[model samples]
Target: MTQTVMHLDDTDSLERFDAALDALEGHLKRVFADDSAEADRAVLAALQEQVRVLTEERDRLLTDLEAERARVQRLKEANEEVSGRLEGVMGALKDMAPALQD
Candidate 1:
């Protein structure tokens, strides 16, 4: 048994996919140059639908990525604020410690 893994960052795979799509499109054009075959039209329609679905998915992923980035930025800001407050409290405690020792 063999398992295959794909990564989003695999540019070579993406390039190959694109090349394959291009080749398929060229072949279809040559086969259906007369534009009268119902089967060819159906295949082209299916391909276009697939492209639309992929485009929608890409848009959704981009939107999700932007939202995640915004959330991360907000979390970083909150962490910094908490850290500053903690430092201030520590400083106040240190000041009171010296007074108590006296």
Candidate 2:
């Protein structure tokens, strides 16, 4: 049998994943409930392969997200440092203006 491909979003939740799996299982059960041996084998093989690919893709995205979160946290720290320097500069300017007016 030819492979069937699905385009699933990377951010799907565990509940959603479970539901999708359950749905496919129910569909297969209904479709193959009194079918010949050949059809039952085909359905089982297709489900196995599809589940493998989907789980792999989901794992990859979660790994990528963790890496991205770390990068964003570093950036946030850098921005805080810059903001502190700008505040200091503004304070210094404020002090200098009062002295100049004397």
By lDDT, the best candidate is 2
Question: Scored by Cα lDDT, where does model 2 land?
Answer: 0.75
Question: In model 1, which regions exceed 4 Å deviation?
Answer: 1-39
User: Candidate 1 at residue 70, lDDT?
Assistant: 86
Looking at candidate 1, the ten consecutive residues that score lowest on lDDT are: 5-14
Tens digit per residue, CA lDDT, model 1, 1-102: 994543455346445656666676676566667566667567777876776676565566667657766876999999999999999999999989989999
Structural similarity to truth (TM-score) of each candidate: 0.61, 0.63
TM-score of 2: 0.63
Worst 10 residues of 2 by lDDT: 3-12
Instruction: Report the lDDT tens digits of candidate 2 across residue range 1-102.
Output: 995444555356645876786687677666667565466587687886787787786677678767866876999999999999999999999989989999
In candidate 2, residue 52 scores what lDDT?
Answer: 73
In order, candidate lDDTs are 0.71, 0.75
